[model samples]
Target: MKRLMFYCQHILGIGHLIRSTEIVRGLTNDFQVCFINGGEIVKGFEIPDKIELVNLPAIKTDTEFRELQVPTGFQTIDEVLEYRRDQLLTAFNRIQPDVLMIELFPFGRRRFSAELLPLLDRAKAHGTKIVCSLRDIVVTKQDQVRHEEKVCKLINRYFDLLLIHGDPAFIPLEASFSRTQDLNCNVHYTGYVVQQGVGIREQKIGNGKQAASTHLPTPLILTSVGGGRFGHDLLKCVAEASKVLETKIPHHIQLFTGPFAPDEVFEQLQTIAQHRHNLTVDRYTPNLLAYMQQADLSISMAGYNTTMNVLTTGVRSMLLPFTGNDDQEQTIRSQRLEQLGVVTLIRPSDLHPEAFADRIIECLQTSPTSMQFDLGGVKKTANLIRAIVHKQPVIV
Candidate 1:
């Protein structure tokens, strides 16, 4: 079996890590995978036993994206950087992977170049085919032209394939990266990479008819703030909204305050949640998809993975995109999904409990329907990699 070394760095949210895990899970049956995680470990996330896991000293950024912190302990930033760089370089030399797969490099996470530059140099010397895995839309930099130039330079110098994990018909990559014309490597779209659970839901949702309800079980509402770093406001709003909704909807609210939430914020939410017997607050869960599958409605931020879950499960959802650091990626995604009638968008100004409650009422009243997306991402990605490994021509 060929060896695959995959590197992923997640700073603010676990979307990158979660998406990469699903992809790696699909790959373990075919490859000897070495997974390098460059961010804080999300404790409950499950990775396959066949994949070798390397956890680096955890690093994360604030919501503003201006400050980087070593959340795991007292190590200095430079100290951890040197440690991770050495470890990463050593892993590449030791693994000598048949394929080098990197998540969000030149397109984003440019902050880790201290090590990535050196690792890329080593991989090139060994003639390992390097692939870049990117999400659909990218955060736009203020000096975008200069940023695009830098990205083009890196791709031209190091990468063999640019695998965009999205469908062009839904939202083309060029929608965000205006300089796509300049990159020199081969680019392919493997469709939207959704959770594995969602692919199977299509059949179940197809054959099962909605049960008529004279006495419906209390509707289960699932709410999550992806990564829990910046979603204190959203959680607070939902808490307040729950009080307003109690008399009318009488639903059960399961609030997940992502693992990274500050203690003070989580405590505050816990205290407020005491007001409602129908509400429960937790740090994280290994089985979010299970909750989503059973939920009547989902209230959350518009992170890629969670949004895909919402789409896959056909749950009525209300989305508030994180716009901190002038990041418009989530907002753009939310808008497209809203236009496609996939989700309802929540404006920042309307995030108050009262206004949020109003939106929840709307979502609850709407009928649940799943849209068909190109969910062929994992299967297609595996095929493309195999073709590349065997020097077979690939067409997306």
Candidate 2:
């Protein structure tokens, strides 16, 4: 059997792990997949029984720069680098996999490049097929040429394949990466990777029937803003919006404050939600799909992985995208889908309590239906990985 090594590091939220889990689930049958994760986000995933996991020293990011903090109490950058280097070298020597897949390297996770460069060198020396997986977006054109030049160097030197988890027809790669066609032979568009679970058939909602009605409400409105590290504005906006719409539109609001939120904020939300018969506030829920299934509408930020999950469930959604750190990517994506009549985009600046409530009400009024794309990409990605392992040509 072909052996594959998958590497991913998630700092802000569990989006990277979520996407990686989809890929691992798809490849489990034909490959002996090993996962190397080094962050708090790793604990969030329900990894498959067949896959083996190796936990590395966890690292956290600072607000100013992508500084690495060792979980076992390291004070200096050199100490962290030396420790990670030793760990990676040992892991690579032991695994000796046929392929090595690095998630978000050469584009997003540049901080980890200190350890990754040496690992990539070792993989290349050992004849491992090196792959770099990217989500649909990267940093904006803040320093356009400089960013492109750096990425171009990495693409030319290290990666054998650039696996993009998006359809270019919807949002082209060139929109983010300059001179993308220069690396054409190595690039592959492997559609969106969505979350999966038992008894969850593709495109089927609420087990193919409406959920049982209760005294509380029928059509629920589920809302989340990733890990709640940066959702204070969003949560406040939603809370105020719910108050405005209480009398006009009767629906229960399930607000997920995310895991990283402050205890005080969560407590306050809980208290506010307690008085409102139509509102419920809680921390993260692992079974988000269950709520999405029963939800008449979803109000959420247009994070890359979150949007994909929302689209997969075919729920009428209103997206509130973050304005900083090249988050315009989400805005672009949500707008494109909005043109397709799949979702509605609500910019952060334009968001108010009343406006948000109005948008939610509008989405709830629409009929839920199937999206246009064939979501067989998970299986397709599995097949492609298998073929690559066996030295067979992939037809794009």
Compare the candidates by TM-score and give the number of the best one.
1
RMSD of each: 5.1, 4.2
TM-score of each: 0.92, 0.89
**Which residue pairs does candidate 1 place in steric collision?**
none
Q: Per-residue lDDT for 259-364 in model 1, tens only?
A: 9899998888788777776677778876777778878989999999998888788888989998999999899998998988888888878888887888888889
lDDT, candidates in the order shown: 0.84, 0.75
Poorly placed runs, candidate 2 (over 4 Å):
42-44, 63-72, 197-217, 368-371
lDDT of model 2 at position 125? 93
lDDT of 2 by residue, 202-321 (tens): 221121223344222457788888766676777878877878888988677888888777789888887777667677786776666656766788888788767877877888887877
Cα lDDT of candidate 2 equals 0.75
Model 2 residue 272 CA deviation (Å) reads 1.1
